[model samples]
Target chain A: MLKLDREIRDAIVAHAKRDHPDEACGIVAGPEGSDTAARLVEMVNAAGSPTFYEFDSTELLRLYREMDDNDEEPVVVYHSHTATEAYPSRTDTDLAQEPNAHYVLVSTREHGNSAGPVEFRSYRIVDGVVTEEDVTIQE
Target chain B: MAIEVRIPTILRTYTDGQKSVEASGSTLQQIVDDLEANHSGIKERLVEDSGELRRFVNVYVNDEDVRFTGGLETELSDGDQVVILPAVAGGC
Candidate 1:
């Protein structure tokens, strides 16, 4: 099971809403432990539409280096689906290079309404297979 | 009944901009054949001529990965969702 803190979930939702009509992408960094609470590190707008997301690996390398400097490692990678559900896209499954990393997705479709809860899902992509896991968001 | 195959955006260029298509088959291979019959070259994009899935592509049935199940032989029932996902590279 994967768990997220309230602040992290809110940060992801905020990023998704900020990039509405397009995709938003980011990574999560934290300690390497089961009890470690992940936090959203860097957020960016995906350069393309829902069909594609171009995360600048150069920026990622910088962030990775920064995390290294901070003594933290990226533990999760996340992105948002603007008009789609919080399900892993085919592109997401194929590009999942970090098997040990948790893949998180947030759906911001039903925005602005009280019932429009942000949908968050986590997955582990290994060898071209995406395995869904139960995600617990701590309040 | 035929199952519905949902195509993602990247591969839609090959399917003439079709986002979702319907095909008849019980197994994943049969569905691929049906897709090829209609789209002509979709099979080549999803699978190699040697009958192996492309390294950059992934097929999922109802959110469960076909690779972990039976791969091309994975049985399909009505309303099963087949998602073809390719690797996405980009970000900074």
Candidate 2:
């Protein structure tokens, strides 16, 4: 199971709505080894395709460096699935390198650019296998 | 061998359950080769016999995907972090 702050969850939903049609991807960084996500770092989708998502390489590098300097690690790696369910696709599971991080998928298929019932789910992708986990929103 | 290569859980078996290892290389390919020398079986999983990155594998140099930077030719600096992971779908 993964625990996310209500604010972080709302922000993720906002990002998904903001990038409707095209997928949005980002990470939430937390103190290294803490397993608690604290900071939100929204990223540009390099692919910019509704069917695909990739992080902007240069921005990703800078974010990683910043996290390192602050003794942080990506605790929650998230992306929006504009037209699909809140689940990890083959591509998403393939790119899940951080075994310790929670992989969150939000489906904007219902809301699109507006606000409605968004499906936000979490998973643990290890070695190409995705195991869905419950998400607890902390107020 | 100042570069730190972070091995994913599936690949940890090759590194004797190690999460991260240190190796040296000026380029991404060399670093992978060095990793192969120390941890066998990882190279085959990451790189194809055609000498290209496997379709399912994603190699990131300092959090930047190597395919975008320069593939196996991406330059590396000391203390850089190399991460290797499988490529799976993100949505249903």
Candidate 3:
């Protein structure tokens, strides 16, 4: 089972909301483990709009270097669907280079209402395949 | 026994917003056919004109990948979860 922290979920929702009228993308950093209770270290935006997400491999490399410098590894990568549900599209599957990393998708449609609840789901992409797992959110 | 198929977000519009559904089949292709019987346009979204999985789509069984196993012929069992994920291209 995949586990997500409440804060992470909120962050995903907020990021999706912030990018309303378009899609939002980012990365989730944490320790390497199957445990869903891992603490989120950071949320880095892809930097720009609905048509494209620029993942600065250089920045990611630097961050990875820093993490290596600190003896840690990046755990997961996350992004959002502004007009759709929390599922991977064909484009998403094609670009899933990190088979070991968790792929989290947040849906921002229903959350438009202040009273509406946010919808988020997590998955694992391995060898170009996407598998959805139950995500347990921790407080 | 029938296998349980999980629908991804993008295809939900064709499935009337269903996140998961049940289909009777022993292989991925059969399951997809069963789904198309109930919901039109599903197979089109998942497959190309030549019957290949779309470039942006990924189907997984449990934690294993269907492509590495057998593509459309991958075997299935009752209660097994099949996840359909399409590559998401939109982002800022």
Candidate 4:
């Protein structure tokens, strides 16, 4: 199961809402070997398309270097699907390289940018296989 | 010339779980060839059949993306750092 703080969950939802038409992507980093998701680093969607999301290459490098210096690793890698369910698409499963990270998919299809519930789900995608996992929101 | 290549987690299997390894070459392609010689089977993961860098893999030579720096032909010097990362990308 992926345990996330309530505030972090809310922030992810808000980010998805804010980028309604375009996909939003980011990562939550924590100390190496620590599964706790403590630092939320929002990434720019270089694709800037509703159906696609890609972190800018340069920014990606910097992010990795910073994480290296801090001895942190991405605990949760997240993205939003504006018109689809909170699930991993074929593309998502194929491109998932972080086998250790919990892939979070937040779907804003139901409410768009409005104030309503969105589907926030987590999964583990490894070696082209995606397994949906339970999420426990911690207050 | 010795170049330090930082391997990403996903590719550690090719490096015997080593995070960084030393390679020698004057260009990116030569460096990849040297890596393949030592690691065996790693070149296929980074290079496609068409002799181009794989789409999902990003290679950097000293902070500049190899794609912007003449791709596999990017010149390298001794003490240069190379970082390989899988691009964070997906589409619905």
Candidate 5:
């Protein structure tokens, strides 16, 4: 199970809504070994396609260096599925190299940019295997 | 020439959990070969059978992306730092 702060969850949903018709991707970094998703680092979607999302290479390097300097790790790696269910696609599972991260998928298919509920789910993708897990929001 | 290679968490298995290791090479390809010589099966993850860097893997030499610096043929010098990171990517 993944415990996420309520505000961060809302922020992720909002980001997904804002980027509707295009995929949005980012990571929440926290102190190393903490497993607590504390810092939400929004990233630009270099692919900028509804069916794809990739962090810019330069930005990716900077992000990692910052995390390393702070002794942090990406606790939650998230992306939005603008038109699909909140689940890992074959591409997601295949390229997910972060074995210790909580892969969060937010699906905006039902409501698009509207204020209705969206499917927010979490999973663990490791070694080409994806296992869904529960997400508990905390105040 | 000794180059310091920083390994990502996912590829730490190849470095026996050491975040960074030292290898010798005058070019990126030779460094990879040296890495494989010390850590078998790691070259396959960084380089494809076609001998090109994997699409989802990013390699940097002293903060410059190897892609723009001749890729596998990028020259290296002693005390250079190399960092390898898998692309943070996916799609639906």
Candidate 6:
């Protein structure tokens, strides 16, 4: 199970909503090897395509260097699905590089918090396989 | 001459299951060619017969995606960290 703070979860949801048509992507950093996601780093979607998302390479470089300097690593790598369910696509499963990080997906298809709750899910993708896991939001 | 190339799980087979390996080059293409010399068949997975990066392969140098840096022609240097990932897609 992935233990996420409610505030962090809400913040991620808000980001997803903010980029409704374009997928929002970011990472939560934690102490190296600790697996605790504590810092949120929002990234620009270079593609800015409703159907695709790519992190700005320069920003990614900066983030990685910052994490390295701070003795941290990405613990939660997340992206939103504007029109799909919260599940890893084949490409997602294939792209997952951090076996230790939780891959979070938030679907904004409904695109409304007032209408109904959004689909938020987490997964462990390792070696081309994707396994859906539980997400516990701490109050 | 030794630049650390981080390997994703799916591509670990080409690197004897190791998560990272060393390659040398002044540009990204040369480095991949160097990788192929040690770990065969990897070049095919990353590049197409058309010499273009396979549609799904995403290569990065020091956390910067190569697409914006010149694709396979991206330059490299000592101690640079190269990462390769597949392009993930999500939508209904």
Best by lDDT: 5
Candidate with better DockQ, 3 vs 5:
5
In model 5, where do residues sit more than 4 Å from their true spots?
none
* lDDT of every predicted structure (CA atoms): 0.71, 0.83, 0.66, 0.96, 0.97, 0.82
Compute the lDDT for candidate 4: 0.96
Compute the lDDT of residue A10 as modeled in candidate 6. Answer: 91
Between the candidate structures 1 and 5, which one is better when assessed by lDDT?
Answer: 5
Across B1-92, the per-residue lDDT of candidate 5 in tens digits comes to 98999999999998899999999999999999999999999999999999999999999999998999999999998899999999999998
List TM-scores for all candidates, in order. Answer: 0.56, 0.79, 0.53, 0.99, 0.99, 0.76
Q: Clashes in model 6: which pairs? A: none
lDDT of 2 by residue, B10-74 (tens): 68889998868998999999998999999888899888899998865777887778888989999
Report the lDDT tens digits of candidate 5 across residue range A1-139. 9999999999999999999989999999999999999999999999999999999999999999999999999999999999999999999999999999999999999989899999999999999999999999999
- Give Cα distance to truth, residue A103, candidate 2, Å: 1.2
lDDT of 6 by residue, B1-92 (tens): 78898776568889998978999998898998999999999999899999998866778887777888999998888889898765433333
Cα deviation at B62, candidate 2, in Å, is 9.0
- Could you give me the TM-score of model 3 versus the true structure? 0.53
In angstroms, how far off is B19's CA in candidate 6? 7.3
Model 4 clash pairs? none
Better of 3 and 4 by TM-score: 4
Estimate how well candidate 6 is docked, as a DockQ score: 0.31
Error of 2 at A38 (Å): 0.5
TM-score of chain A of each: 0.86, 0.98, 0.80, 0.99, 0.99, 0.95
**What's the i-RMS of each model?**
12.2, 4.5, 10.2, 0.5, 0.5, 4.1
RMSD after Cα superposition, model 2: 3.6
lDDT of 2 by residue, A20-54 (tens): 99998898999988999999999888877898877
Model 1, range B1-92, lDDT digits (tens) per residue?
48888775456766887868898899999999999998887898789888987755667787665778888999998878787755434221
Model 2 alpha-carbon miss at residue B84, Å: 6.5
